[model samples]
Target: MTTASWLAIAMATIVSAALAQEGQTQSEEIEELEEIVVSASRIELKASEVGSAVTVITAEEIERRGDRYVSDILRDVPGLAVNRTGSFGAFTQIRIRGAEANQTLVVIDGVEVNNPAAGSEFDFGSLLVDNIERIEVLRGSQSALWGSDAIGGVINIITKKGQKGFRGFASASAGSFATHDLNAGFSGGGERYRFAFDASRFSTNGISHADEDDGNPENDGHTISQGNVSFGVTPIENLDIDFTGRYTRSFLETDGSIFNVSSLTDLDNDATVYQRYGRANVAYDLFGGAWSHRASVAVSDVDSKNRSNNATSFTSEGDKLKLDYETTYRFETESIPDAEHAATLLLEHEKDTIQTSSMANEVDIKTNSIAGEYNLSLFDDLHLSLSGRFDDSDNFEDEMTYRVTAAYNLRETGTRFHSSYGTGVKNPSLTELFGFTGTFVGNPDLEPEKSKSWDFGVEQGFFEDRLVVDLTYFNSRVTNLITGSGNTAVNLSGTSPAQGIEVSADAEVLDNLNLIASYTYTNAETADGTEQVRRPRHIASLNVNYRFLEDRANVNLGIDYNGDQKDTRFSPTFARSIVGLDSYTLVNVNATYDIHENVQLFARGENLLNEDYEEVFGYGTPGVSGFAGVRVDF
Candidate 1:
């Protein structure tokens, strides 16, 4: 049967189930749909009120999974694909809805951290899951609200904040491959002031970047040290000030290319990377919180150096500064009783600079943008939002983008219908326009890539809200796609089309057991009807969490499956050809026990089945490995 047929059947089944349970009241003990989401709009709103697809990963879930890297935690999200070049600390990338890696925007505490020197892409290799309170993954075209580099989606990483009282935590862990991880943090707050601090270090003697089975014997090691600080103060009534700062330094052992053809050989190569990010904000409220104003500034800096045979061969530095001001007004009218409305206006300016060893002069790009948003909620049943943005850039043509979203709830039937439509634009990156030595040639005439996307979904609840299911269909078309042609970056004349389906379910099977599962089917193709590289046709995951031993001990089991995909291969015999990668499945298990009220012990096993798999061609993956850790809270 065709994909359409499958979708039709699934929709019919869900609708029928919803109708069967119409007019039923939810049990009081069942969970409610009151989760607050901030990334979907300028202001906070309930998840059910947002029309776009969003997934929230909480700190509790991160702890239960025992994943050291944030990328590992995102593998289970629908419509997302994570590829790690090798083992831990290797280069990692994520694709959303078959979009290019550089199209996804990453925000860390209101700071854009994309590397301007590397084609505006954010490498997830060095992003650890330390001191993170929650992560909101907003999928789809979001340029209308977030400006550039948001053609695919947006990821907002929010760190933990200070609480009413003083608290602190420390953890130590050791695992396979001679790995060690240590972290500590403290947070405190009062009526007028709050502060938090965190520090961590991780080191591992990882396997070879090239596949060991291919005669690579050398071991590549990686190390990282990171620190974070946050402070907030309320000097007077209705006025607030906040600040955040983070720094990360990392070292990785890489592999060199063989005869300038393949990077599948074990050669002595290394890289050092440093990242610094800071943000400050001031906000005030007027007219009893009906009107609010905010101003903020953020900065990000990245420096990287690569060495070959103990000699520095390449170095690059990039920095970005952003300034933003926003005002929002909320009101309700007697004509529309119980209806809520909000209007927001935003102004932003951004500047990016890149300096590399290969270039004699530093390069800079600047952009100024204005955006507006309006939200309406009718009796808490019908929600609607409209947003628009205009951007003027020094390097690219002026662009305008817009987005519309709607969400409707049938509370009597426990059903919701959500839909969104948006347009996006991505400017040419510095590297693509100016080129990098020995890699890509300059293409100053390259045009900006543009896209239009839309999605519709239905969410249904059953068994007094004990089980919930969501299904969505998304489609997108891109024009002037930036690609490499014989080492020269150029824009394609034809349009590339992509479509996909995402299905996810969360169920409370028992009082102590919970299950989550998701499946995605994607059909991404180039203009010539060829499948896009690195995008799998099918992906699925399942996870189960159970609590036992008087709620003091917990266990989690996770399984992930990646379907066959195509990748490009370069060999001495052939210039380049498409190669097929076999499908693989991995199983992971984690368990935690509370030794005391303020202490816990945990252990996790990765790749328990020992299935040999490679996310990227010519890269090696870790075998079965186990880790044990202890955490103390005071």
Candidate 2:
């Protein structure tokens, strides 16, 4: 059935169930379940209290999805679009609220990991989901809290910490295309110290990245190896320290196309990438726990090499170092019961350098930032937040950005009204500022892109919070957007505007059954009112999960739909040109059976419908693939 039909049926059922349960005892339902988030305000705040649109993916939900890459889990999020070049380990891009791929900032354990040599974007394909505890996606402009490369939003991935007791898990899976994945992890802790470690290796002999009809029958393959280690210690009564390190190495088969265009497919090519990230933090509490101070240092390194069949190679390398410090003070007032106030101050400095064999000279940038935020609660039902940031960059002009947000809760109706307005900024990437000599040239006069954005959303609870519905409308106007000129980089004169509406409904229909549905409508246009490339007008998803057999077995079924949009393909008569890519639907299923307290058997099938679709022109996507695996824990 079509996505609309499924939505209709689900809506009808929800309405009917709400009406039926209206006369029942409302007290029978357990309410007061609140999620705490740290991404919105840089401090722990209840999800309902934050005056922004946020989504949290818990580890439980991650495990239930049975996904190998982080991109798979993010695909189901609303107001976001994910596109992959070809197969696993290939280039991946995630756009939020119709923003450019480089506009979003991705953070792992308080470290920014965007590649400086590239377009200041992080590739999600090489990120594995082995030791993640939760992911907080704060949608919309976040420059007031973060620095550059946050014009769209921020994604914060929190890794798992050691618990009180010993725990570990190991899993192995094999699937179509001769895919193999092995992962293991262990964590344990005591009152004073704790440690966690994880490792994973994945390899796939995959399909051709180009269309098989292109006369290149050679299959492209990929391999990835990753490791993570973390340790924490509390030596004093009010002092805590932690250190984390993560490494990833990937080798991929690629088609020899400089711009990844359709007509330049070549099979005899390969590439390798290595990424390393490390962080250390020290936190202390003072004044009887009324004030908290933290200091952290982080480092990121990325090296990539591409080798062609003709025995030619090109290499690029990027390195970054950052130091940050923050302090927050909390105040309480007896005049307004249950109301509190918090004020925070932050300071940061970063240096990034990029070097490429193809460029005659290397490029480096340095930035210093100072920011502050204030959060206030009034009458225990209203929340107000104000924040501002100032940044000084060596490669660009100084920038100042600010934001204001408000959220109110209606206790009687179980509803929340939230709104936020913010400004964001993004600096030009190293490649845009200093391009390769013979291939592309750079324009030093380019200005940093800036955006003004706002979002208004309402959340309501029905049937005693068993069913929840959310609707949000957001708009963004970006100025000085960078676009490619004739072998050079230039900023556009006019502004680009994007507006969208997001709708989501989640219901716990029964004690053992759950349903989730979401839809997004976006109107993305250029300065002259032209449709943007590769951005769909509509996207929808529906998911259902059920548990049976004495709660020992569980199953999940998901449906996803993508609307038609614009793409570029090579035309025999016209050479390379723009074209319309067709819309398609996909269905997926995952099942798990618990054999013992420490063991489980699982299986998953992707693209069960085997729908033929192209996210990017001339790129191949998987079809009707299945995998089975066993997991053990102790």
The prediction achieving the highest lDDT against the true structure is 1
> TM-scores, in order shown?
0.95, 0.96
lDDT of 2 by residue, 1-634 (tens): 5465566477658655754565364457565668999999967899878998888989988887787889878877888888888877789999899999899999998889999988789999799888899999888899999888988899899999897889999999999999999999999999999999999999998877875556556678999999999999999999999999989999999884544444547568888999999999999999987899999999999999888884658889988899999999999989879889999999999998999998867789999999999999998799999999999999888999999999999989989999999999999888888884456787888899999999999999877777788999999999999977667889988999999998888877776777888888888888989788777878888877889999889999888888887876655443446689888888889999999978999999999999888888877788899999999998
lDDT per residue (tens digit) for residues 471-588 in model 1: 9999999899998878788898899999999998876666677777788899988888889888988888878799999989999998887888988887764367888888787889
Q: RMSD to the native, candidate 1?
A: 3.3
Q: Candidate 1 has what TM-score? A: 0.95
Shift of residue 433 alpha carbon in model 1, Å: 0.6
For model 2, give the 10-residue run with minimal summed lDDT: 256-265
Among residues 3 or more apart in sequence or in different chains, the pairs in candidate 2 whose N, CA or C atoms overlap within 3 Å are: none
lDDT score, residue 157, model 1?
97
The segments of candidate 2 whose C-alpha lies over 4 angstroms from its true place after superposition are 1-27, 258-264, 310-312, 334-338, 570-576
